[model samples]
Target: MSERVIAPKSRGFLFLDSHPTGCRRLVDEMWQAVPEPVPAGGEGPVALIIGSSAGYGLAATIAGLARVGIRGIGVCFEKAPARRTGTAGWYRTAATARLARQHGRDMVFLNGDAFSDTMKEQVAGLLAERFGGRLDFLIYSVAAPRRTDPDTGHVHASVLKPIGSPCTTKTLVFDDDGAPEVKEVTTPPAEGDDVEQTVAVMGGTDWERWITYLDDRSLLAEGFATVALSYIGSPLTAGIYRQGTIGAAKSHLEATARALDERLGKALGGRALTSVNAAAVTQSSTAIPGIARYVGLLRGVLGDAMVSPTGQLVELWDQLTGDGPLVLDEEGRIRLDTWELDPAVQDAVAERWSVATSDTVPELADLDWFGDEVRRLYGFSVPGVDYSAAVDTEVAWPTRIN
Candidate 1:
């Protein structure tokens, strides 16, 4: 008799025992739309991707191997396979490693907190030994609710509140019956050290630390490039996202890019930049107030115009490594949100937002698709997967875990 894997239960926001087949399918779709590029190096360009398990980080890692042919290392925090619960990231990372190998690429998915200096040092040391003390690229795409500072031993938690005043918005949440419920939310303005704490948790401090440590130790190759992801949305949710405590953090991130752009050039002829990404369905985004309903409506409005994470990544890869000049906005950062913010798209979204209600939402927004996207992020609701089949919750990860 053979042991079989069973579906794990969800503990609130956390889910366990992800479907391997679903994860593989999602990865396949991401690469299917991407055009493979010319191989860069024999072992591919040595690279590191922070927060490289799901969402943009996962898509970027897939694009790096399939499109850019980069042998990359990923840093993320995920629970290991357990008796009754194994994290979705564990399954995704396992599948990613297998896919990378099938493409004859080298990828190491490290399980640890990217906010920690210890993990950074471990990654730097590994890069030093494995790639002859040089890394060609680095990507920062971490999204965490809280962070514990290594130097000060202070824990900072991020808030999603607006900065100046209280505001009311409609947010979407799934009921116990798995049906969508539209809820009215009144959020107060951020006060006191909320902005500082949010920035401490979500800002560019850790990013700068990693770069300085690696560059100081001569781990970065000359002309190396680094990018961190940011989001600036439409006017509807601007108060909570673009102008909120998180926005303060993003501002710090952009400032870090400016400083590092000059510092990197001076240190090793390298470059540092932030890429403003388009909004999409992800584990992190769903929790944001009012973002779910907005994204659901946006999907309906944009339809074919909407860019998937992989699509954005393909464009990013081409722009960052292509033959033409580095295309950047006046702010010296790449703009990947142009399509999402198109007049036609935003006009439709704004129109829907004005008239949206629980009853009318079903007709206006593609909530079905929005729900599926969220499920798929956790390796559920994928096609061709037999939900009844037993799954191995004890599947081993082929990478180091700290």
Candidate 2:
């Protein structure tokens, strides 16, 4: 008898994999939506955006420079080392670099950790030395689990919550029946190091490091501005984010922005701001423990209007270029996710939440479509791909990672 071996458990890594052609299609679609010529290079003024590998970081970088006529160099830390489905950042760098070259701009890729002093010094030096010590904008966004601190040699910890209430909630996963349903609360380590570690890497310290180093070297150009990314979701993710360790870190990041804004505004006649951004499922958002539930729920309500794997990217570009139709406060933090949490929407979700406990619970009205977008985000559901197409396991990347 022939033995049948089952596939290995996908673990969380499945979330990391991305389909390049789909992502490229998304990128191309976004690029086309920009009404003006995207220079593809921030040649004259210097701009820096970290965590520039995937999702918002990548989107913001592209959008900021597209119409602004500045050629920029992108630095990212990626594991898979190439422009393949395994490492989305690699694909982004590879594809973006190609566009840069074609557009008569310069794009360089530096692969490494943003937290270490070595990386910090390297980045700062690159700014000062590479482009004549001038920067017009800086974006500090680092999301990682751990980093070896170069300073006190201690791994600084990040806390995710106020030390008070511990909220818990329901989540969903496919059961043996091959159908999706709620799973009980996935309690994180009650003790709490992961949150702290995540906050340290993702929060404000690295952001500060980038700003201070660049400023000390007198690299900031006049009228320079900087922004850090943040999120405050509806109460659904309260247990996993706001009430969780990462939430604590986000709180720290928000407060730190206030602090940095004052100092940077004074010194460089520039500003350090916060963008409490829109929610879309990206690699970082998915790993936050119970986030898949929110992704599904949010998707069900808004459906395609909620998030488009490709068009939303154009939405980001529109926002960056001042052509966006959404409302924004003085801080420019557009509350895109807030509209989804209006009272009526929340009530509807609550009703669904109650039914979520049952085996026969129905799929949220727009869930399949929502899932379709999410799957497309990972390159699973794009048009024109034959599932049986042989994937080149030995595909070479545009730029090789170190």
Candidate 3:
């Protein structure tokens, strides 16, 4: 096998990896941090997670395995290692499987397009053969740039624009030299079928389809629970986020949760819910317009209470499988972002937002911290990892994938 060579970090170029050592170290921290397990009780041991490679999906998977010992079947779309660049998620998934095996737990991974029908069937078949055709939990956390429907073969592209009217905000961009650059961006409202396309791509249509397919095949256990991640940001971002095209998709997602809640009960004696998570820096969030500035401001104001992906999942697991009744809003969805939307927190953020500008952002927000978090996501800022060391990109991934 060929070994991967490391290149020095260059200004304006994307940093892709922090070497396998650093990647493994980060994975170890997550797994070790999982809270001590309580009795499983009525909760089933098996879970199927879509988009389980990075961000919230990876956090939930780690928590499930470490905290509750849930058997994991993860499906993600990622690039395989070659001669030059390797994906960070490939390392993360490989590490997860290795850890699970060492702990004597089952962890299966399938690397393919999550939106593909063939992928669904492949996973469903594996579940039947390995897990006896019943899954206790299913989590959908897919974030992608485009989607192609399996049945119709139609492609839908999603946009991030405000609805009803154009809106202007301060958007952050990274310069070629890896410096932060701010620009006043005015995004036009969704035109034509922009709203519909965005909804089709990011909404719950795929999630609903997955459930329908799984239930039809008797793949879900009785009392099974399904959850999809959503976000309703603070008032400052309502125009571009909550009330925008993306928000339209989220609204559809919540509606699907309601419909699935009823359908699951009738069809398989199960439940479905949408979890409103906190606004944090993720691969997806940073791509949105003006999100970096908002997150930077939020970090400065909220301090350490800004929840992490790992923390979010730990709390979510407690609610899902704990002894207490699941805390939910009147709409039957979980609100894990109680702190992000706290009245006092919002008031503070609003006050800062009113006075925020490119010139003032550095003073008012933790922009450096926000940048560090983003770099860490791409395996760039990990401690003790030598950026100048040669990386073996051809390091073997698991071959016994289900």
Candidate 4:
């Protein structure tokens, strides 16, 4: 491996390369932010985290390791550095595994499409052989544009559009000055099988399959728990989110959780539910049409009250493993977005949303902070990291499950 200075490359919100040093530093910070772990009885807990390379999945993995002292197996699809630098998630996972080792915890990563049957089989086998043939928790946080069905061999792609009429909303776009500008974008309605396809890719079909496969193989432990991460934004962005194609898929995901909860409860006294997490600057979130503007307002209004992905997961881990009973909404889902949806918060954001313009965006919303947050997702613009220095682009995973 050769060390080279890698500048941050981006077009709009998409990142092309990642900095290893920055990624590792960010992961290290997340690990340190987790509260000191309580002693684990016997061999401790084990978790299987799907889509564990970045975003909420990565945060959950860190909480499991640092907060709960749990050994974990993570599944993610990320590109390695070859002609260009590896994806941010690749370096993040590598860094997470390294931290797990430094703390005497076991973390195994598998790099591949988690939607496929092969990956499931591999993880199941690994659990049976190395993890005492039992899993305490399973976290589903996969975010992808398309998925190839292992059973049907059909490729389904998810679209982020409203279900009925076109949705015109105020969004944020970067201008020539490299600053966020308020813009109105109209997303057309879903046509053809767009809704079906989105549901196929983002829905609970695969989640149910994973649980069934593991249960059939006798790999689920007593009192097992599984959670699939979801998001339901405020009514302002509902047309393009909660009431959109993605929302249709998420509805299916929630329904699947209910069914799985029943099945698991009857079988092994286990539990399954959906965790509606707070909106944050994630690689997948930046692509949503109205998210940038909403998040900007959110950041400005909420300020220190808004929780980061790692912070939300840390609370979730406490709720899950603590002696206190897990809190649930009327819908039986974990509501981590309560702060974002608070009446006071929404009222404050809506007031700013109506008056937000390109000129006033900076004042009304924290566009500058939002922009930096976007860059930080790709391992750039991070504090305490010298972007000017040459660093190795290639990073290695500590233990990669074949």
Number of the top-ranking candidate, with lDDT as the measure: 4
- Please list the C-alpha lDDT of all candidates, in the order they appear: 0.83, 0.62, 0.82, 0.90
Report how far off residue 250 is in candidate 1 (Å). Answer: 0.5
TM-score for all predictions? Answer: 0.94, 0.82, 0.93, 0.97
Every model: Cα RMSD to truth = 2.4, 5.0, 2.5, 1.6
lDDT of 3 by residue, 250-301 (tens): 9999999999999889877788999999988877887777888888888899
Instruction: Please state the error at residue 288 of candidate 4 in Å.
Output: 0.8
lDDT of 2: 0.62
| Residue lDDT tens for model 2, 117-167 | 777677677776677778777766677667666777777654444334554
Task: Flag clash pairs in model 4.
Answer: none
Best by TM-score: 4
lDDT of candidate 4 over 75-101, digit per residue (tens):
999998889898999999999988877
Off by over 4 Å in 2: 1-9, 12-18, 33-44, 67-69, 81-86, 156-166, 175-178, 186-198, 307-336, 357-362, 393-402
Predicted structure 3, TM vs. truth: 0.93
Candidate 1 segments whose C-alpha is farther than 4 A from its true place: 1-17, 37-41, 323-325, 400-402
